[model samples]
Each structure stands twice: as structure tokens, then as C-alpha cells.
Target: MITVKAPGKLYIAGEYAVLEPGHPAIIVALDRFITVSVSEATLQGTINSRQYAETDFHWRRSGDQMIFDNRDNPYHYILEAIRVVETLALEMGRPLKIYDLDINSQLEDQGGRKYGLGSSAAVTVATVKALCQFYELPLSRMDFFKLAAIAHFNVQGNGSLGDIAASVFGGWIAYSTFDKDWLRTVLQTNTFGEILASEWPGLKIELLHVPNELELLIGWTGSPASTSRLVDKITIAKFAEHEQYQHFLAESQKCVQKMINGIRNHHLPIVKAEIRHNRQLIKDLGFFSGVTIETPALQELCRIAEDCGGAAKSSGAGGGDCGIVLTDHTVDQARLISAWNQQQITTLPLSVFQLTEASV
Candidate 1:
């Protein structure tokens, strides 16, 4: 049996702008994860994905004839992972040959898909790891990262690549977008990929599961947001020759730099300040409007977090999945949970994981 585990991720900075050529982003892999264990199939029948109860998936292969039984549009995530793996296998000159396989997935919770944690990225990483193991292919973490990025883009149409990078590297990473000159002239000329293949850098990070003290409350806006649309909107707004958005991006970058300091020095105050400031910059871009962040529940929750001596911000793509709440290490998790319950907001216990040499 091959057991593979992948970590979730959180975008610390450079959300929308990271799509640009010369921008950078930062993300941290969380302790939360999705694990896949694969073994040879004993019964030759059909492959079944029994992870999500709400979704039914079945695929059969009989002498080159294949059939896929699915309900929802299988392009979102898990299905995309399967497709990407199949494609990668073919690219490696190995046509996938599996009689049958069973996949069981565990989301953060059984009820709702939570935010702040990158579940999609975790699933993508796990899928890649499982495929690599099954094929007996030797691949570095960065290689898996590249595969996961392909899966992510297939699902979201466009991805920033930060989440996959964080999950694979498992530390705070400075994911700077290379300038055209850097990518074309420097990297291509110097063969940057070869350099990375030869040298590995060591970084320090801690992932903690403080379930009791560090409670997080997340709410949805009852509306789905397209990550690609948000990216396009930000790009147009930032490059439209508008001074206001230009200022916002500049300020956001500065705040992100402060966040980097916070991570390096373990300064909670700096992290909170930078995240709060950056949230405002995102808000100014009009992405937060008419979305979940504009919902009364989210606004009230933000106020509650602030009153309780903490801060909160929308997690991914901002149309709303979840939000991260910063609180004191001594804060009462039960109290926060109870408060959120009263307000009809669901709570999730956050985890902090420290990257190890072996794990990374």
C-alpha cells in the first residue's frame, strides 16, 4: 500500500496580483490535509470514488471501452485530479492501467466545505503523490507541485500556483512571479530548473493544532464566486491606468512585506495589522461587494472578532468559502464557538504545522 498525505494552504499575500508576470505571493501549508492510500485492485470491476456522499462517481474499463458515471459537473476538483493524473501518465509514456480503485476523501468537516484552508490544493497534491507512487516514478516535491498546478488550473480555469507551491514545500515561501526578462533571458539562459534540481533550501515553519484556543468562524454568502473572474477583474482594474487601484496594489504589497516580517519574527501584531490592511485594499477593489463579505453575517462576525480582540478576512477567491480569524493564544475556543453558534456561523479549529525536512 502506498500512503500519501498532502497539506492544505492559506494565501498570506499577493492574491489577485500574483497572476501578473512580475508579482509575488506568500502562502503557508496548514496541518489540515487529505490523505490517499492506494493498493493493487483485487477485484476487476470498476473504479469507484466513495469519498463524497453527495456525489456519485463510477468508471468502468472493459477491453478499451470506458464509461464514466457522474452526477455533477466533474470538472471542479476530484475529477480534475483524476484527469490530470491520467494525462500525466500518458505524458510519461505510460498509459494508466488500473482494474479498479477506491478513493475515500475527508473534507475539513462532514457538513460544509470550509475556507481559509486550501482543500482543493490538498486534494490535488494527494492525487499527484498517489499517482507518482503507483507508477514508481521518482519525483521531487517541486515536480508534484507543477502537476498539482496543472490540476488546479483545470479546475479553477486559472490558478495562482501559490497553494500548490506551499503544500509541496510546506513552509512560508516567497513565490515571486518572474519578470519577463527573468523568465526569458535569465532563467532560460541559465537553466534555472537545473539549478533548482541540484540545490535545495531549508526553511523553518511550525504547524500547530490549537483547537481549543484558536477557534475560527466562517460563513458563506449563499453565492458562488468564480476565481478566474476575480483574477480578470483585478488585472483590468490594476492595469487600467487607475491611480486608486495602483495605490491599493502598492499598499497591499507593502503590507505583505510586513506579514513576511511577522512570520519570520513570530510577531502576531504585525501579522494582524498587515492582514487587516490588505483586507481593506481587497475591499477597495470591489471584490468584496455583493459577495459574502458584504453579508450581514460576515460583517457582524468581523465585528465580533474585533471586539473579542481578533481580526478576520475572507479566505480564497473572496466570493466566500471561509475566513481566517486571528485571536490570542489564550482565547476560549468554546466561547468563540458558542458565540458563532448564536450568530449561526460555523466554527473550525485552526491548525499550525511546522515543516520538517522529511515531511517537506
Candidate 2:
């Protein structure tokens, strides 16, 4: 049996801009993860009968394309993973094999509430790893990231794939978005053969050095944030044309640089400053876009973290998802937790997920 686990991710900075070409985002792999176990099977495709069994899935081939049974199924990533890996095997002249896999995740609550950790990305990463291991394919972290990213992009048309990078490499990472236009064209126009013929383009990923003095904490607001809806609320603008939006991106770019440099150089102050700037910046975006970015609970979480001598802000889409907290050990974590509990926010237990030999 091949058992593989991949961690979910937290967005440190660079949310919207990362969607733009060549823009960067700082993302970290969380200790929370999805686990997949695969073994040889008599079936020709995937054999999953766990949490995913609750969802509908179909697997078959079309004229020239290998299509998922249910393209709109929420578990489409799982089918995409199997299809992509199978395409790789055929391209490399390796015999395709069947496998039975079990999927499990730790990113949600017992009541099925997602903590806003990147669960879909995590599952896709795990599926990629499990398939590679089952096939005895020795793919490097970057190679695995590309394959996993293809699967994710196949399901969700838009994403920076920073979560895939973090899930594969783990720890702190500064990631640049890939060429979305190229990938979209390929997926839209190509068949299974064409997809295998077009190898993945190299995407930039840098492992960031986190300061020893920095203490990271994750807290969940209990309400899920729909990132797509929030992005839809904003109007994309040219930097020179829309003055306010231009200023927003400019300020965000500066904060991104400061965050990358601060984390890399062990400069806590710069990182902290950028964190606060980003929180307020998102609020500003809310004001201009007329969409509420930070909910009352999220605001209270940030307020409590700031009052406790730490900096805190929403990690990703923000409407009411998880927030990242930065501080030193001197801050009373218990007090912060108590305050959050009072506001009904759940403090998440997490750390940077480091890769090891056996886990993959």
C-alpha cells in the first residue's frame, strides 16, 4: 500500500494580485492535511468508497478525451488526478494499472464545516502523491507540483496554484502564478493525448526563511468564505486608469515585498507592519468594492490579536474564513484564545508541514 499525505495552505499575503500574470503570493503549508492510501486493484480506474463516496463520480473516455463521469461534481479533482496520472503513464510508455484508493481529510469539522484551509488543493496534492507512489514514478517536488496543479486547474478554472506548491514543498514559500492563459487553452482544446504531449511549464517557487522569533497562529471564524464571490465583486482595472484600484495594487505590491523580505531576513517588524497594512488594505477594498471583506467576528479576531501585541488578519478571501496571527512567544496565547472563544471563533492547531521521505 502507498500512503501519502499533503497539507492544506494558508495565504500569508498577495491574494487578488496573484491572479495576475507573474504576480506573487506568500503561502504556508499547514499541519492540517488530507491523507490518501492506494493499493493495486482489479478495477481499471480509481476505487474510492470513503468520504468521496458520498459524492457522485463517473469515469470514462470520450471521443479523444478522458472525461470525468460528473464534470460538475465537487469531487472532480479526484477524477482529474487519476486522469492526469494515467495520461503521464501512457506518454512515458508505461503500462497503465488500476488502483483502489481511500481518501480522508482533517481540514473540516465533525459537523462538516470547513475551516477555510485549502481542502480541495490538499486532496489533489495527496492524490497526486499516492498515484505517483503506486506507479513507482520518481517525480521531484516541482514535477509533482505541476501534475497536481494540472489536476486542480482542470477542476477549478482559476487559481494561483500557490496551495499546490505549498502542499508539495511544505514550509514557507513565495510563489509566482503560472501562465493561466496557456493552461486554459490546453485544457479547453486538447484531448488526453494532447494533454500528455504538452508537458507542464515550470512555475517559480521559492522556499522562504521564517524568523525564529515569529510565532504563527491560525484561527477559524466558523463561517466559510467564498473566494470566487469576493473576487467577482471587484472590477479589474488598469493600474494607470483606475486611480484608487491602482493605489490599492501598488500598496499591496509594497506590502508583498516587505513580507517576503521580512520573513527572509528575520525582520519581524517589517513583516508585522505589512500584516497590519494588508488587513486595512482589504478593508479599503471592501469600502471601494461595496462588499464586506471582514465580518464582525473576523474584525474582532484581528482586534484581539493586535491588542495582545500580535498582528492578525484574514488569510485568504476574508469574508468569514480563517485568519493568520503573527507574534512572539511573549504574547499570551491563552488570553488570545479566550478572547476568540468569547467571539465564537475557533483557534486552529497548526504548524508548517515539512516533507519527509516516507510521507510521500
Candidate 3:
């Protein structure tokens, strides 16, 4: 059996500013992950067929076709991922065919849904990693990153590519898009397969559970918020006022230093402060409609986090899947968790780690 454990992630800085070119964003991989295992199988259908069992799923290969089934949506996401690889293989004139393959996964956060962490990206990374092992296909982290990006676009219609990049490369990364068509990248990624691998280590992050005991409250306004809509909003907003956008970009950049200080010193205050300011900036840019953030449940959690001396903000595209919070006192974690429970919201106790790789 081939087992791969991949990490979810949290964006530390450069939230909306990443839409502007030349801005660098920082993220940390979380202790939570989506684990995948592959074993040689004797089954019917195709080598690429998928099946699910509880937190696990299997994909088997038949003679020439591929099939997929899974207990988790992430598997559907992965099946979309493999189609990307197949397209690439065909483009390169090295068409890949499956004999029979099985896939199983364990995602331990938000009942296996995305809670602001890169769940889709992590699953995409694992799928590619497993495929690499299954076919003996030699690929670098960068190559896998590109493949995951394709998968991301397939699933979400549009994505920043930041999450997949962090999952595949790990550690710290700086990614920016200067114009409409170009992206610039620099990796301080933590992994075992690079020349500077010996010097890079995992980043330290303290995960806080807001006391309310609510399973992370996700308030969708009954419709999914399209990422493209948000991105286009920012694009038009930027051109109308470069000076303001430039200033916001510069202020957002300051979060990088704040994050570094918080991580290095284990100072929760700095982290909380940065999160508040980051959320405000994103809010100021119109990512939050007054109504979405105004939802009673969401507003309650935000108030609870603030009351508990923590900071909270919307997670994904804001119309909501989840919101991320950072707390001040570890001692108050219980109180915070209890508060969420009382409110009937979900609280996930997650740890943050910068990207790094295991010895293969």
C-alpha cells in the first residue's frame, strides 16, 4: 500500500491583495490533512475506478478504462484531478491508461468539508502523488503543482492557485500576479526533495478553538459566491483608484512581518491584531456585503471571538463556507469552544504548520 498524508492550510497574509500583482502572500499548512492510500488491487471495471468506505475510498483499474467513486467529495475532486493529468499526458504524447486502481481518504476537519483550509488542494496534491507512484511517473513538486492548479480550476471554475502551490510545495511561498496573464512565484517551501531542504524547517502556528463550541458556523446566503465575481469586482475597483489600491496593498504587505513575529515569538496578540486588520482590509474592499457578515449566527461568532480576545474573519469566498479565528489565551480555549457548542455552531480545533515533506 502507498500511503500519503497531506496538510491543509491557512492564509496568514495577503488575503485580497494577492489579486494585485507584485504582492506576496504567506500561508501555513495545518496539522489537519486528507490522507490517501493506494494498494495493488484485483477488481473489476478499470484501474481508475473509485469506491468509498467511511473515511476511506478505493479506485481500481480495469483493462483500459478508468472509474471513480468515493465517500468524500474530495474524491470527486480528485477524479477531476486525474482527468487533468490524462490531458497533460495526451498532450505530451505519453497517454496513460489504467489497469485498475483504488483510492481511500481520511479528512479530519469540518466533517471532511473545507473549513477555510485547502482541503480540495490537499486532495488534489495527494491524487497526483498517488498517481505518480502508481504509474512510476517522475514528476517534480512544481509539476504536481501545475496539475493541481488545473484540477482546482476544474472544480471551482476559478482559483487563486495559492492553496495548491502551498500544498504541493509546503513551507512558505510568495506568489503574485502582476498583470492579467502572468504569475510570479518564489518558494521558501518546506520539502525533502530540494537542494536547500536541509535548511528549511516547519513553521510554528498555534491553532485556537473559539470557545463557542459551534462546529465552524458556515452561513451561505443560499447561493454559492462565484470566485470570478469577487475577482472581477477587485479588478474594476483597482483600476478606478490605483492610489488607494496601492496603499491597501502596502498595508497588507505589513502583515507578513506581523505574521513572522507572531510565529517566531508565539505571541498571540500580534496574530490576532493582524487577523483583524486583514479582515478589515478585505471588508473594506467589498468582499463582504453588509448582509452576509450581518447574519445573526455569523455576527454572534464574530462577537464571541472578539469578546474572548480573539479575531475572526470569513474563510473562503465570503458568501461563506467557514470563517477562521485566532485566539489570545490558550486557557480560554475551553470557554470559546463551549460558547460555539451552546450556539450550535461547529468548532474545529486545528493546528497550523508551514509546509514540509516526509522522507519518502
Top lDDT model: 2
- The sequence of per-residue lDDT tens digits that candidate 1 reaches over residues 234-276 is 5566556468766666776677767776766677777777767
Query: How many residue pairs in model 3 have overlapping backbones?
Result: 52
Per-residue alpha-carbon lDDT of model 2 for 239-283, expressed as tens digits?
323777777777887788888988888999899888888888878
CA lDDT for candidate 3: 0.56
- Each candidate structure's TM-score, on Cα atoms with residue i matched to residue i, is 0.74, 0.89, 0.66
- Ranking 1 against 2 by lDDT, winner: 2
Instruction: Give each model's whole-structure lDDT.
Output: 0.59, 0.79, 0.56
Off by over 4 Å in 2: 43-46, 53-73, 186-202, 235-242
lDDT of 3 by residue, 78-182 (tens): 677677666545444564654333543333332434355666678888877776666566676666766666567566654466777667666545554323232
Please give the range of 10 consecutive residues that has the lowest summed lDDT in model 3.
195-204
RMSD of candidate 2 to the true fold?
3.2
The candidate that achieves the highest TM-score relative to the unseen native structure: 2
